[model samples]
Target chain A: MKEYTMVVLVKQVPDTQNLTGEAMKEDGTVNRSALPAIFNPEDLNALEMALQVREEYGGTVHVITMGPPSAVEVLKEAMYRGADRVYLLSDRKFAGSDTLATSFALKQAIQTKIPDFDIVFCGRQAIDGDTAQVGPQTAEKLDVPQLTYVESIQELGEKKIKVRKLIDNGTEIVETALPVLLTVTDTANEPRPFIAKKLLKYRKAACEFDLPKILPRYPQFKTKEELKNFLKKKGLFIEMWGLEDIKANKDDVGFAGSPTMVKKIESITLTGKGFKKIEPTDEGIAHFVAELIEDHTW
Target chain B: MASNGEVWVYAEHDWNKLQDIGIELLSKGRELADELGVKLASVIIGDKVTRHATILFEHGADKVYACEGSKLDNYDTAKYAKVLTDLTGQYKPQVVLFGASARGRDLAPRVASKLRVGLTADCTDLQIGDFKAPDGTEYKKILYQIRPAFGGNIIATIVNPNTRPQMATVREGVMPPPPSKKGKKGEIVKAIIKMQNLPNLTSILHREKTEKKVNLKASRIIVSGGYGVGSKENFAIIRNLASVLGAEVGASRAAVDAGFIEKDHQVGQTGTTVRPALYIACGISGSVQHRAGMDQSAKIVAINNDPEAPIFSIAHYGIIGDLNEVIPMLIEDIKKRRVE
Candidate 1:
């Protein structure tokens, strides 16, 4: 079997489903701190697809994410689920990035860190933005073919890969050459649960910022560098990279590189007045039906 | 880079018939162009789609760029993106619009990335407006791409101040198609497609266009259920009401996510937008995202046990009761009234 090298992109998004009034600031910006961050739902599907591919073809699944330093939590979660390696791309310069600028940064990171990737998997869209643009845009930036809304991998040969993708009112099976990008959908597969053994082993994984809290607990490690070396020896270090690590242009990595800007944001509020109340009795129902008929609403 | 002061819409089609979203965009494109004092153009790519240009003109396009070839009959992302990008480079239109359908979502991002311009997805509204940046820079007469974000909790107006040919994709049924004129005149330009060296990367082995199982867009009345509908078994009551009233069934995102109904029946920001004659929301709390889809209906009725449910705010008739009891009575009454 040909051992393939795969990369899966993931994100930690605010749980929008369980949002409260405090989820939005008075200025119409999202109060991300008020909401709990979880691994993006569909990204788990992408991770599962990559793990399945690795299981069948004897390969390694590398997971990567771009966000704040706290995003390393998702990297650790990926390891618990079966990822072989994890990397975090974080920097203050990479803030306020739209999908286009975000794709450029991810493409640069991929080129710098994992240039020999055979397949790159991404979720169809994240719940936060729901744009579904970054995967295809990154494929365009990387100058590779893309397959979006992939439901399954029909066949995988040495150089060609066949995939079934969902479309409007139908589905299509397409064949593309190697090094193609795929955006997996929720319908693709059920994500596997965390392995207890892997959970116990990878729970100690720590990134650069996590060392401040983690190192103090262990007096044997005198310095952060020594702690990092020890974690690296134990395969428990989560790699962290910034804009410089990926050789990204300052003008192309964040707000300055984004072409679109938010002009205004209005919080939605429902306003209802002067509605006719109806009783839920038999007579009341009959009267309402008769009125509906009179108004031709039926 | 300066634009050519024209608004362009990508005219998607099935065979020779223009898709609904394409026509809807032309209607919007015409309004935007008239506001800016410019011409409205449309780009149609398919084999022998020149006749469709007349329909585009009737709808609202003042100019149609027809790229005709046998190989272009079926949609190939690479080929279509190349044609649109090349035309954009040549003409430099001030604004471009695409339908946020499957193909549009797949192709728009590629073109936007290739041009390094901004592209907003699933915009609910677009207008010509002015924008002032945070650094005191100002832009006038740019496209204000308005869309709901954060699960429709807030509406954001986005502007591409520094990028030319501001691009955005609007979902179907969000914008209404303009009335067709008996005879409308427009210039038809034949675009020369150069596909010699482009890599033939993807090959479609098979395609199955299933008959659309549900089309809430065309329904005159909709009976929608929400998470409060309880469970999959209780959804039968909703179906009974819809069948009695001769209405199509719809569901909110909550109901769909709870496995109470199929996603096709979802009427919300993430599913389908519908403007029906009558919309009866059953046991639905009416989140902002759900209201964004069906709020345009002519009349709305809400039935929920909780009086504070947001659905009652927009509803013309508010019934505060259990849907299980109210729906059965309503169904029986309607059935008896029809015979009488």
Candidate 2:
């Protein structure tokens, strides 16, 4: 059996479960700090799928994320779950990226860092953008075939993989050659929880962002490079890449490359009207049915 | 500019029957064609879809491009995508619409990628408008792709001004299906794609239907329960109500997460979005996540213990009470009314 190399695309999203009115700012932008940051739900499924592939095919699973410096938290979580390597794709020039620009930057980063990977995994969509376009768009940018809504892997051959994809009514079995991209849905599999040993080992994981802040605390490390060297030597550090490192055009990486713009954002609020409040009695039930019948509710 | 001056709809169908979304797109496409002073076209790719062009014509297609071959039979993504992309390149359409069904969702992105055009998936509403860019340039006949974003907190309107044959996958049931006109005919363009040259990477071996599961998205009436249902066994009340009302059973994320029901029955942001004719929410507090899926129902009836539950705000009828007590009474009354 041949070993496979997998790249999983993950994102740190604002927790939508505990959302509140304060989560949205006056400018229609999300106040990401108003809510806790968590790993994007579907990305966990993608990571789990990648890990499953690694377990079966005997290969390494690497995770890549694009966000602010704080987004490295997801990388730590990925390491705790099971990722051989992690890379952070972040820079100021990458801000305000829509699905297109984000995919462009990610494609460049993948091409630069892991060009020989067998498979690229991504969640169907991000909870924040809800576009579901980045994965497919990124596949297009790389000129690779992509399968979306993948439910399971039926077989993994040396050159191709057989997959079952969820359609609207049924599942479609497809075989795609290696070096393909797959966008996994939540129904793919239940993501395994963190292992105790891995958690304990990776809890001290730090990237470039944490080096400057933690260097002051360590008396022995006088320079940022020295601490970084120590952490890299200990295998407790994550790799960070910027626009220049990936050779991505600045104009094609951010807002300038984005074609879709939010012309407006309208908050939806339901006004309670035209509804008859009824008590939980027989008469109330009778009136409701009578009204429904009169209005042809059936 | 390749202005074919026609609006095309991809007629998605299984081997047995045509998908309703195909006709729904034709209905919307007809309106767009009239607005743009163009013809409405349909593309069907399958083994025996040549005979189904009349069906497309009746559903408002002014022209049908039928590509029939054995390779097009089982919906190999690569082959069907190549046929559609080739046809589109040969005969360019101003705009193309596809059903946001499973096959449509998969194929649209591939064709769009090949064509290097923009595609908006799962659009709830589509409109034709003239878009004025912020740079002061004007684009005519733009496809306004409207869909819920940010977990349904807001709606975003997207326009693909630079791409030809602007593509969008309309969500099933968002647009009404036009009544078919019997014996209606249309011009047919036959392009038999040679499958020998294409890459055949995948093949289906055996297909077992994964049980006849709940069809909540396609159901006309749905009775959904939330975490307030208390226990997994307490779901009997919801099932009993659905049986009496002849409706499908649904659940919120809380109920599904609690193991009260399976994931397929979940109706929320992460679940299936539905636009049923009537929705009865029992013990549901109507969180944004839950409401995002079913707020488009024509009539909503909420039954909850708390009078201030957010579900009541969008409901057409609100009953303040315990669902266990209220549901049994409603079921009994409905049964008696049916008997009478």
Candidate 3:
């Protein structure tokens, strides 16, 4: 059996569905701090697909994400669900990156760290942005074929792979050559739960920012760097890479590289003061329907 | 630098028949081109698709670019992107718009990335406006791509001021097609598709297309449910009401996400935007995302136990009661009236 190297891209996004009143600022912009950051939903599906492929074909699944240091939480979650390795592409210079710039950063990281990868998987879109551009843009940057809205892997071979993709009205089974990128959709499959043993083992996995909290427990390791080295030896370290580490040019990594800019944001406010209250009784219901009929709203 | 160039719409078609969104965009494209004092052209890339250019001109296109070949019979992302990218680079279109359909969503980003320009996704509205950078650099007459962000908590207006050929994928049904002129005149250009260097990496094995079961955009009235509809079985009440009233069944994104209904029946920013004559929201707590799709409906009726649900605010008639009870009574009342 030939082993393949698969990379899954993931993100930690604000829980937009369960937003609190404080989710918005007085300036009518999102207060991202007020919302809890969870692993992007579809990215979990992508990870599950990668894991399933590895189980069938015997490969190592490497999960990567680019965000603030807090994003290491999703990397740890991915480890608990059977990922072999995790990388955090973190740098302050990468902030305010739109899809194109973000994809450029990811492409640089992939080429620098995992250039021999056979396949790359990504969620169709992130919940917060919902632009769904990063996956294809990254594929273009990598100079590989892209399969978007992929629902399932139909066939996999040494040189080619086939997938079922969801279209506007139907599904198409498509085959592409090796070294391709796939954007997994939510309808693909239910993500597997965390393995209890893996969870217990990786619960202490620490990135650079987490070293301080974890170092207090390991007294023999006097410094955070020492603790990080010890964790690396124990296979519990999540590697963090900056823009320079990935060989990305400073001009192409952040707001400086982004073409689109937010001109304005308006908070939606609905006013319903003119609504007529309708009773729950049959008579009121009858009268309401009659009015609807007379007004041709029926 | 390309401000005086033509505004182009990617006219997608199914087996040579132009999609409705293409015509709709041509109408909007006409207005934008007129405002910019340039031509409004459409690009249709498929085998034997020249005949569709007639409708494009009738809908207000000033010109049509038909790129035809036997290899272009079906949509191949790499091939189509290559042709469009080459055409865009050569002709220097000032603005490019796509329908934001599945194909559009897949193709637009690839072309935009190749061009190294910005492309906004799922724009609900577009306008010609001026934009100023924080550094006091002013840009005149740019495309303002308006869309809901953060799950519709706020609407953001985006601009690509420094890029040529400002590109956007506009949502279908938001921009209604203008009335067509029967004998509108336009120029037609036959574009040569150069596929020599393009990689053919993907091949379609089989395609299964089910006829679209729900046409909420064409429905006159709609009875919609939300997560508060409780269970998939309880959704029967919503369907019962729809059946009784001869209306279509619509579901909020929450309802569709909860597995209470299929995605086809979803009505919201992420789903179908509708403007039915009557929209009855049953047990739906209208988020801004939901209201973005249906607030334009002529009359709205909200039935929810919670009086504070946001659906009531935009609804013309409000019922502060349980939908499981109020809906049945309303259904029965309408049934009895039909019998009488």
B268-307 in candidate 2: lDDT tens per residue?
Answer: 7778778898999999988877987888899898999998
Q: Write the per-residue lDDT of candidate 3 for residues A181-225, one digit (tens) a residue.
A: 999999999999999999999998988888888787998989988
TM-score of each: 0.96, 0.92, 0.95
Error of 1 at B168 (Å): 0.4
TM-score of chain A of 1: 0.94
Q: Candidate 2 local accuracy as lDDT?
A: 0.83
Error of 3 at B175 (Å): 2.0
Per-residue lDDT of candidate 1, residues B1-340 (tens digit): 3345799999987635678888889888989999888999999999999989888999989999999898887787788889999999998898999998988999999999999999999898999887778999877788999988877777889999998779998878877779899688899999997988786368889998888788899899999999999999999999999888778999999999999999999998878999898999998998877988888888899999999888888899989999999999998888786788
TM-score of chain A of each: 0.94, 0.92, 0.94
Pairs in steric clash, model 3: none
Error of 1 at B158 (Å): 0.5
Every model's DockQ, to 2 decimals? 0.71, 0.50, 0.71
How much lDDT does each candidate structure score?
Answer: 0.89, 0.83, 0.90
Overall local distance difference test of candidate 3: 0.90
- In terms of lDDT, the poorest run of 10 residues in model 2 chain A is A262-271
